[model samples]
Structures are given as C-alpha cells and as structure tokens.
Target: MRGFLHLGCVYAHGVKNVIHVMLENRAFDTVFGFLNHTTDIENLVGKDPICNYVNVNDPTSAKACTSPNLPSKSQYDPDHQYYATTNEIYGTNDPNVPLPPVAPMSGFVQQASIGALKGAPIQDLQQVMASFDPANIPIQATLAKEFTIFDKWFAAIPGPTQPNRVSAHCATSNGWYDNSKIIFGNNCRSIFEDLADAGLTWKAYYQENPPSIDCLSNLRFSSNIQSYSNFLSDAKSGNLPSYTFLEPKYGNLPQNKNTYTDGHSGSSSFANAEAFIKQIYETLRASPQWSSSLLLITYDEHGGFHDHVPPPKAPNPDGITVNDPNHPGVVYSFDRLGLRVPVTLISPWVPKGQVIHEPNGPQSDSQFSHASIPATLRSIFKLTSPALTKRESWSGNFESYLLDTPRTDCPTTLPSVVQF
Candidate 1:
C-alpha cells in the first residue's frame, strides 16, 4: 500500500472516497421510527404503544412495549445472539416450531426474559421493546432527515454481530452464525484484501481496542488498521485512502456518558454515540475531501430489538450452513436476512429527504443488506478481482443511487449533537 499506483477507477460520480461507519446493535425501528411519529416515513408512527408482546409466564399479562427515549434501564443487552434472535423472529426458538408464513415478529419480551423458553421470569423485559426518540440520538435522526436513508436495509445474516459484520466485509461469513471468541484465523477474504489486491488504498480506523474486523486473518497482519485518533487528523487533512471503514469503541467502557460511543444497548448511551458520530460527520464536512467523499452510517444488527418488518429471504452468498458439534441445534441455512437496521447515505450527491426502500438495480426489487457495503465498494472502485462470494454479486448496492452531479449547497456543518 506504499506506492504511487495508477488511478484506474473511472469517475462514476463526484465521490472519490467512501467512508462506511458500521456501529453496533440497534433496530431501525428503535432508532429511526421516531420519524413516523412526526413525519410520513415508514416507521413506528401511530403505534404509540408498539407491539404488546405476550407474557409467557402469564398469558393474561401484558409485558414490554416500545416507548420513546429509553423509558427505563436496558437491564441486559437484550439477548441478540443466535437462539434468541430466532425466538424474536419466529416467536419460538424450538427447532420443532416450523417457520411461519409470516414471521410472528412477536417475541422480544419473551426472548429478553429467558430466550426460547416457555416459562421465564419477566424481570425488566422492557429493554428490548424500547425505542429511541429523535431527541435521544439527534445526530443520526438529523442526518436521516437532511440526507438519504434506506428503509429496507437488512442485516446480512439472521444472527449476531460477528457474522453480520463478516458478511459486511467478506460478503459471506464462511458459515459462522454466532459470535464465538474463537472465530479468529478463519481466513475469510475481505474487501480490504480486495482493495489491496486492486492497488486501491484503504484503512480500517478503529477506536480503543480492535473490532470484529480482526476476525479475518488478512486484516490481522494488515498495517491499514489504525486508531480512531488518526481518523480525526486524516479527515482534517483530507488525506484519506480510497476506502475507509470506521469502527467505534467496543468493550471495557468507562462510566462517562459522553464517551460511551459504541451505542450498544445496556452498555452505552445514545448521547455518547451521538457525540462520536458528530465528530466524524463534522470532521468530514470540513475536510478537503468533503465534496468528493461519501459517508455511509449504519449498524451491525438489530440486537434483538423490536422491529415490526419481517425480513425477506436473502440470496445465499455460498451454499453453506452452520456445523458446530459443541453447540448442536438447528443448522442455520443462512438463507434468511436479519431484522431491519438504519442505513443513511451522507454526501453532496444525495437528494435531501430521499428514501430508497429497494435497491435501484435494473429490476429494483431486492433490498440492501450489510454485504452491500463491499458490493458498493467493488462497484464504485471498479475492482478487477472477482466478487468474494455469490452474495456480493447479488447484493443490492447504492451504485445506482449516486448522482452524476454533486450539489453545491451541501451542509458544511451537521446539527448539534445530544449532550448529557
């Protein structure tokens, strides 16, 4: 990555560099649904009392429902792992329970209580159903309002963070569905490798500790990974690579709300995440590359939160399924997509208030998944290498959404971030 390479990529749009900010667990409805309450955006509007999930312990009892601005403490992280997600989607994690014609999308409270089980204590089960008001995370809501936001963006897989993030980079997870700490050295081919192979410079700027990007062997030995601090200086100087993927801080968090940047429920605050995102947006806005740079902000998965949208069937990247002897359960086919998550496109090329529910391909029927991150990069940079997997080839990307002309009136500064 240390040479004067040929600029082989064509000018498809005004964008010369792309920055993708992939954050942690939170449902699209939990975060962006406030728009529906105030505007006509397809979200949890009018459903003031969002889904009243059944109390398994007592059928006559009413459990958690969606409330604005985090009505109470997010007791636990809300059990967004494999089996819990299954219960959250299908209303039962029991393998015997057949997939319904329509996903029940009705087990958040149950899953949060004891996961897939029939009888469980309903202690603080409201965390999974709690939605964020626009005032809670003003930065994200403002960006969605001022720029372009995709309503049908789903996570790449119907599982945890690691697998979906792997799909975000590798275009497939090599059949891993859960976030096992032992997933290192799996040798998953990533977009960073593809960029390096194509001689297009790229960097993965991370905060504090290493992110799930370290799950791939290629990035383990890569020098392209740098601290989040470099992101600020690099953006200030506008000396960014062709592609940049930013990862927020994860694990071992301090008590300070202003620095809780990861945005994961129960662990970090929305205001803290807003502070982090505000810096990135404002820095990029003032950078020399602002006019030619496009920023994409999204999450990894829904984290077992309540999203009413039933995920559509997804095209399998590879014909692979989970096979773990230690954890024997339903063998996941990786065919269905995870819950909806917010994906916003911030750039001078995007039309304000634009909402693309489906991919703007020739058919324009398929919705976007996390794999579209690499798929869009491959399409934009015009990489020579073949797609990492079939899913990348079929991934609904944002290549067609970019305008040929860049707008001169793009905002130079974002709205004020929420503070404690």
Candidate 2:
C-alpha cells in the first residue's frame, strides 16, 4: 500500500482549501472537443476525432457527422442508462460477456437509437448524434484556455450518474453498477468522513436538496452540509471550510426554478451551468482564500454522449467483483475506467494554459478518473491509514500542477455565452 508519507512532502508548501464543483451529463467532446479545430489549443491537448452518426433504420445509409448545436433544452435524453452505456463503450449490447480488451467504442449511435425510439419522436431521436460548437460554450472554452485542463479525466464507472458519483465520494461503489440502486437508504464511508476523522474541516453546499450528500451513511456530519445561499456568504466572510463540494441544482422542476442551474438533460440551458460556474469563480477570486485555494470543475459522466477515447485499465477498488444479476453472465471487477469527461484545475499556483494529460513520472498511468478525487484529498489531508480502496490509493494526485510560485495575472472573469 502507498503510504501517506508523500503527503507532507507534497502539499506542505501552500494550498489551504480545495473546492470541487461537479456538474451533470455533458461529455468532453460534446462541449469543448471542437476546440481542437483551433491550432494553439489543438497543439496543447490534441483532439478527439470520433464523429457519430444517425440512422434509425437502414444502417448503411447512416449519415456521418458531429451534431453542431446543443439547444438550451433537449427534446430527448441520451442513453446513459447502465446497459446502454455498456453497449456505448463496447460497441455491442451483449451484456452476457466481459468487455473485450479491444473495445472499439463504436456503439453510441446504435444504443442511442434504441433509447430515442423508445418514447421520443423521430426528430428528437436524431439529435443524439449532435454536438455543440465551441463558440456556443464560450465560458468553458475560455476557462479551458486560461486554466489547467485535464484532457484525460474520466468518470469512475461505465454506467450512469449515481454509481460514478459514489466512486467520486468514496473510491468504491460498494457493489452497484447502475443508478437504479442509488437511494437515500444507501450508505458508505466518504471522503467527508475521512476528512473529519483527521480533524479537518469540510462542507457540502447544495443549491437546493443534496443528492450526493445523502449517499453518506453516517448522519453525524449532517450539520456540515449547508445551503448554496450560505456558500456565497461564507466566501465573502472568508469562512469557507478546508474542503468544499458544491452541488448544482439537479433539475428544473417548479420548486427547483430558484436553484436549478445544473445542466442536466431537458434543463433550461447550458448557459445556466456556465453562469453558475462563473459565479463560483468570481466569488472565490474575491475571497481571502483565493491565494491558497484550488478549484476543480468537472462533470459526473458522459451522459450517453459520444467520446472518442477508450477507457483504460484500472485497479480494482477493493479486490471485489460483482456479477450483474440482470445479465446473469456478466461480471465486473471494477478494473476498467469509464468514458472521458472534461476536468479543469484552477489555482494561482498552476500555470496558465497548462494541459495535464500525462503522469509526471513514467511509472504512473496518464489517465485519471473520479477516484482521483478521494485519492487527492487523502494525500493532501495526510490521512494516514488504509485508503478507502486500493484503486484510490493507487490513483495519481494533481499536486504536480501546483508551481512553486503563484501566478498573479490569472483571469478574474470569463466570457459570457451569446444567446441565439
């Protein structure tokens, strides 16, 4: 097992607070992948050349292209369900077998067709293959250019929201492989618990109700969770916790209108998500903690959108594997990571326009997933003991991006989205 001895050596220099904000759905390519068309950004992070198609019937006549626009509200939800995602990754709906070593990642369009045809109209179904122009999401594109972007960051599971999110909070998802298993009744030890045990301060701020915080098994720390309204006040007062997890509003239901900034499927618009992020950035920049803080912005999963890169092999979280009861023959060892999602690291300690896609040392893998969240917190907080899981213990930390001297000219504001 890797020891926490490396923690003191790495984080002892600066960095007092770490703020992580997790958004919903959007894929790396679905949002900023088009930035590859620009020479400078392309030279820095390379590109994802995978383009999708749309064909409900006659597969031979399928049109090949990337969807160009993502409206504020989607008419149909992409197929991000458990089994659908498996097919999206493996290019086959065969749940009876383990994923082959050579996953072609070519089944997105096919699986999406199945999902779209279920209850959606023909027009809505065709939108699955569509993507947004980088020009459409100016805020994210601007931030990616100004801050450090992790081009290879991935979700923790090949499935949907809940499982992958659980992986982010605690290295292991227990035995879950789908969102259906997620409920308020589920319990697990999370990074919050680890932080508390080490005598550190942490907080979970939600726009309305807390989706992720409810996953925690121990209710003793419930007091640490607060409303999103309190977050801005805390930042203004310089009373932020050592670690903070910000949750966006999950949906745009009537009650959620006030807090609904999450960019989930069928929501008002991605502009809301960008605005929410900009608000956080501006608030943090004005806070006294700005100099000593690191902010991470990322998504939970691909949300059934298309990402060209294949997930790499991963360490099994707890040396345990579970067979999918739904598909009697399918078994998972938690040894493979999920599809790619955009992750950006912002801190004055990081260089402007920095792209982190490879491990600093040759011994580690370049790819990172949601497990890196707990792994990083464990390392920085010096929580010496067994890690939540072996996978997190082995995951790479982002400390390498922090420089000896902080940059004073980082941007204080980002571009706004231009509505059509």
Candidate 3:
C-alpha cells in the first residue's frame, strides 16, 4: 500500500522521521560526476577533455588540468557571485549578449582564475574542474548506490549562499538575488511556519550557534531550534519529532574544538565532512525510527563549482524582482534556477540504487529545486494551507520515491570515508 497523507505525515508504512542534512557549496558534477558519465546525470566524466579549463580569451592557455580527485578544498572559493555565475553559465564575460537559451557552462575556468571569490587568488586558480571519484568519498557514494539520487535537483537561484539557503526553507527569497548587503531579509515565511501551523512537531538542529534556519524571520526565536547533540540523543531515545533539519558547523573552529563540517568552498576538511555524514547516517540507521525514516542529504548551492547541467527556466516565486541587487542597473527576475546540486534521498522505503533522472511532477516547468523541500512536505503531510510561494506550488514532490513496503535489505551502515 502507498503511504497516504496524514496529519503527522509518516512514510505510508508507519511513523516517519524526515531528517534533512543540509551541507554547503558543491556542484553535482564536483561531488557525483563519477556515476553520470556516458550516462545521464550531467558531469564531465569519461570524456575526451573532461572539461576544457583554458583561459577565456585563449583556448590553448595553460591552466590547471581537470582531475577526478579534488583535494579537500579548492585554491579559493571561486566566483559564484551573481554576475560571475552569469559568466560561468553562458561561458562569456560579455555584458551585452542575449541570455542564451542553453548555457555553455564554459567560463568556470576563467571565473575561478579571478581573485573575486573569497580566499581565491587572481592568478593560478584551479580546482573548479575537479570531480570526486566514487572512491574519494566512499560513504557518500555508497549511500547513493544504496538509495536514490535526484540527478536533476538544482538550487533556487543562480547566486550565492544567503539567497539559496533562504529558498531551501522558505521556497522563495522574496526577490533577493545576491549576498550583497543582507544576510537574509525579514520578508519571507518558511516551511517551519507551515509545520508549526499544522500542529506538527519539528526542530532545526545546529552544531554551531545560531542555526542557519534562524536567519528566516519566523525561526529567529523559535523554541523548536535545538543543538545537534540533542539530535544524537533524540535519535537514540526515539524522541525525534516529525521533521528535522540539521546545520553542520560553519565558520572557523579549531580542530580540537570541532572541525568545520559544513564543507564551504576549499576551507573545510573533507575528512571531517565525510565523518559527519557517516555519524549522522549511522545514528539514523540504528534509531528505532529507522524503518520509517527518510534522510535527505543535499547541498545549499553550487558554491562556485563546475556542473555541466544548465539550470532550467523557472517561474518567478511570488513574481518579485530585484533591480541591480549586485550589479548596478541590472535586474534579476526570479525566473531562472541555479546550478545543479546533489540531492540524495536515503530511506528503507526507497528501492536500492534508484536514480530519478527527471521530475515526476506534471508541471511543464517542473524541476526539483529547494522549493521542492516545502512542496514535498506539504504533500506527504497533507497540508491544506496556501502554498508558501508560487515556486513550491509548481515544484515536484518525492513522496512517490518511498516504496509501498519497507525494504528488508536496507544496510545498517555505509562504507567508511576514503578521502584522498
């Protein structure tokens, strides 16, 4: 029997625990290109010149060679700024060209070479074309092989962290496009509110102080926020709420204190990030709620990495626009999605080795983005409230991915991290 919608939405089979692990800044290709080669998922794998990272002006210029194994981090963050991404997407720094119907995904090399991105140098920039081998992060790869991977998932916008992160919970950034001056405006409501309104229990857990969801106007003072340590104890005690969102440690933290597990740009240690993923997975697998649990491991945005897939056209959320939020005199109507990110849905109810190549939704413009987070919650929980934004209204849901019956062969553990 299919999981039917209920008040405290359980995975049709039984009571469910939906744990969302929101990581930071990695493109689909940078993380999972190994699986999608002469295959489907859009990455530079098993190809002649996996990716041409030559100079923008001169194709034959010397640059960092594309490698399958990216070091723990990059030389610098790389330029994912709103205007810079426009260049990376279309592969041109030209200011006056019609927005190409299809993006070229060609200028990443040049953009990374610039010093605009944080901690990056103006010269000798590299690592943007790097892709992780399945062996590089064995646990992440094993989980994907063992569960479902959403190949077409994208960020909510083509800009940086703030706006996209806001969209992940709120379904819209309310016309904000850049990391310009605002960390997050107190303008939009988030899915957290929806969960609360419906009498459903949830919590946003963070390893660092001030959970990322706190930036949302509604969650600033929410009592539902808790420490990640609580997540560990709650999972073991089977006291977890209906919905859970996790924020890894961000910013600088001494190795002794706690390594940065957020994995932002090239600063974080891949070893720490992988271990964090492992810890969370093992905890969930052993939990009493394992059978009905669903863990979504995903990134906030591309964070200036290389993803061969071009972002698809999208409906403007709430039909709002930003007039030159970053670039003066230029306007960004929220009509286009951003670079692709990895969305791995892990659950006992999901068939092993499932890969969702396209959307299961009926909307013509249906492409799974951050908005899908709210949309899927609404469907699985049967929320009758108004859509958070026009975007989620048109977004797809993954309730169908949960199998009618829980699988008996689900692994209780994953391969150990093999970070190189």
Candidates in order, TM-scores: namely: 0.90, 0.89, 0.91
Between candidates 2 and 3, the one scoring higher on TM-score is 3
Q: What does candidate 1 score on TM?
A: 0.90
* Steric clashes per prediction: 0, 2, 2
Tens digit per residue, CA lDDT, model 2, 1-420:
222223346544478899999998877767766665335432213433444444324457453435566566664568787778778778666765556886776777777766754545444554554567668777777777777887778888787887887788888787777766656445767888888888899998988665566766674358888898899999988999989999898873577753467677664677778789989999999999999899999899988877777888888888778877777766777877778888888988887788777444212553477878887777667778567887776676777568888889988877776553
Off by over 4 Å in 2: 1-8, 11-13, 36-49, 53-59, 117-126, 252-254, 257-259, 361-363
Off by over 4 Å in 1: 1-12, 36-40, 56-59, 71-73, 115-123, 181-183, 253-258, 324-329, 362-365
lDDT of 3 at 216: 75
Model 2 residue-pair collision total:
2
